[model samples]
Target chain A: MNNPADLRYATSHEWVRLEGEIATVGISDHAQEELTDVVFVELPAVGRAVDAGDPTAVVESVKAASDIYAPISGEVVEVNPEVEADPSLVNTDPYGKGWIFKLKVKDAAHVSKLMDAAAYAAQIS
Target chain B: MISEIKSSPLEAAHVVLGAKLVPFAGWNMPVQYTSIIDEHTAVRTACGIFDISHMGQFIASGPTAAAWLNGLLTNDIAKLGIGEGQYTLMLNEAGGVIDDLIAYRTGETEFFLVVNASMIDEDFAWMDARKNANVTLRNESAQWAGMAIQGPTAVEVFAKVFPDETLPPRNGIMTTAAGAVVCRTGYTGEDGFEFFSPAAEGIAWWDKFLAAGAKPCGLGARDSLRLEMGYPLNGNDLSPERTPVEAGLGFFCALEKGDFIGRETLARQKTDGPAVKLTALRYLDKGPPPRAHYPVVSADGTVLGELASGVLSPSLMTGIGMAYLPAEFSKIGTPLQIEVRGRLFSAEVVKKPFYKPAPSA
Candidate 1:
């Protein structure tokens, strides 16, 4: 699976898409593939404060548990309940409907420091 | 991941089917193909096959084989007739389980023993140190590859694979013309057969079984299937710190058969009862699934013990797990709590086997 060209990625495998002040976050396709058969997801609550690289959420597969990290500093404005109810979406459509949470950027310029799609693709490979 | 993890003969086939391979018990084995729940449900409903080549297999033959085994194992080996098998356990002097295994009486003086993969070296060394001059012990694990074909439709698939052969009945083992040992047994609660063949032949059979409509399942589904049946995993539920008395596997341990390795300790535990008892539990509140090593506590906030095995039971669609709790707190319907990631959730001690086999029509 290829990382979406429009999104920025973190070293921890979370992808971020910035729309004005709101930054949407989800795990990379490679991340979901590694953690196969995701049975449950615990999304961080809306209004929670998170800094870049913070362990913000959790994804659990049948075999193990992994922490989802924050790519940039922000306050969580909304969390995707759909992904929480059906965690497999993170595998099927990781970048779109499977977006985990949306954060109101505390520092919009920090997103520029995140890795590009090509860089993430190289890092994972 | 261990750098020296061994790969099974079916490794190529597993990769071709897009299985997620992981290191388990020093073997690089497939953990899942699609989703664990999907593969688990397939076995419970239709059919599924697993590559269980990592487990250890041993052959003991000679005039003294039966008597030596009787001295080593907790089960009544004398009662197992030719072509029959019995579940048994090897215990430490203190009555702690070394490993749980199945011993098959193939001939008048020959027996086959199958033990857990991780405990192969330990089990062998322990037995080898006490080796009798009359018994011959051979480790056949590296020479053979094993497969478990399971479910209600397993017989049909087996028939398709061996069109001219007769399958063994439950608890029976037969050596095939192609040098494969077919045992009418499985870990999944469903009716199935476990086949062990030469490494090369085993890979071919795995492919043929898939072509014949048997789903290629992995260790993930195997764990859930066995857990649903309340089967105790060797390293997890059965450990050096636990005995058959606490595991609720006393039926397999026959004290009346005479003195075995841990006979005295086991007899004392049987009469006096054990301090810890294994119990089945299901989550009352929906949240993240319980996992091994998670703390299991009493209603009054007393820590009982840690969960031994846990999973989001695919068949029951609920969180199910097994834990060794204090005997007083192990009663059915007793309220308990599980602490996962510092959050407590409601749970209860329930009956054995969270999943039951459907009644035959």
Candidate 2:
């Protein structure tokens, strides 16, 4: 599994890359592999406020649907339209073009408190 | 209250193929080898092999076997000639389905039955309690390992694997020189055969089919393929509380044949019409794949029923499912909604099968 050193991750397998107060969120490679062949993605609505651990989106495969949880409390800033048109992007490029949504962080420090690449790798390993 | 999970004879082969194993019908079975869609497409366009050892097999013999089975099963066993098979159902006295299976006349007085894995003990006990003196029933499920090789290319793969043997006609059963039984039948609407042999030889036969160009498929692909053809699954689409009539399987039930268990209720339902019908539905727009137990709603937002089975059809690239809706709502072109989580997606009642395969060459 590729755990980029610059990105922090939640135990739920979502990776967040913080830029200023904006945190870009997407499921990690390990999560995408577990839920293979993503056929549909339900993105969270913009401006929706979510607390940490809240299920903000859904990623579905042929077999079952999974909840993509909010790693940290934030307001939904933007959602990825690319995944909506072609859901396979989540499986093909989970970390880059497959990002699910962007959130305006409530507290930017919370992003640092989450697991770093090393700790996240250890947990998944 | 925990029970032991059963293992297929070919479990080791599945592990070697890197299959994702899951618990299904109290057995550790592979859900997929590579991916459900990939395997499903293989079975649709090429050839795919599935380990069906988890299903149950039984042998019934004696001079009166045919007459006796005809009384117990919904199909008229008298119609089957030697080496012929037909899909039939065993039902409770109240007309509810006990199990749906294929009964093959392997000989003049002997019949072979392949039943759902979870219904083995119950089906056996139900039959044994009512068995007549002239018939002898035996459960040989544990002695056999089964595999279904299915697809348009299945015949080609079979020819490559068994160059000396000729495949039986559709719904026909033939024994190979090595004592293996090959039946020209499968759940997927494709030209294929289900092979059964001694339990110890499962992996060898599996390897032979694979070497002959059959792709290894798991329960996931098997499910989608069957559902695409609108085949009813025993535990999912069929149950003890529902009769075959409500399941849209009246054609398989021979009402004109003499008396049988559950015939009275089926006959009554056929005349009076079932209040609920197992209706097929397709999503009108892109949505998350529907699944069993999802609440189905009417146009005016009335809760009609829940889905019996549902999936994002790998072939159609749209959500398709079956639900036991009220008879009035079961008609074709009726509008419906499938509620996933809290969102309601529009769907419409359509024909039984969501897909149709190309005719075999």
User: Which candidate has the top score in DockQ?
Assistant: 2
Candidate 2 chain B, poorest ten consecutive residues by summed lDDT: B350-359
Off by over 4 Å in 2: none
Q: Could you report the DockQ of all the candidates, in the order they appear?
A: 0.71, 0.87
Off by over 4 Å in 1: B1-3
Q: Residue-wise lDDT of candidate 2 within A1-125, one digit each (tens)?
A: 79899999999999999999999999999999988889999999999999999999999999989999999999999999999999999999988999999999999999988999999999988
lDDT of each: 0.90, 0.95
Q: Which candidate's lDDT is highest?
A: 2
TM per prediction: 0.96, 0.99
Q: What C-alpha lDDT, on a 0 to 100 scale, does residue B37 get in candidate 2?
A: 93
**Model 2 agreement with the true structure over B1-361: per-residue lDDT tens digits:** 7889999999999999999999998889999998899999999999999999999999999999999999999999999999999999999999999999999999999999999999999999999999999999999999999999999999999999899999999999999999999999999898899999999999999999999999999999899999999999998899989999999999999999999999999999999999999999999999999999999999999999999999999999999999999999999999999999989999999997789999999
Q: What lDDT score is found at residue B359 in candidate 2?
A: 95
User: How much is the lDDT of residue A66 in candidate 2?
Assistant: 94
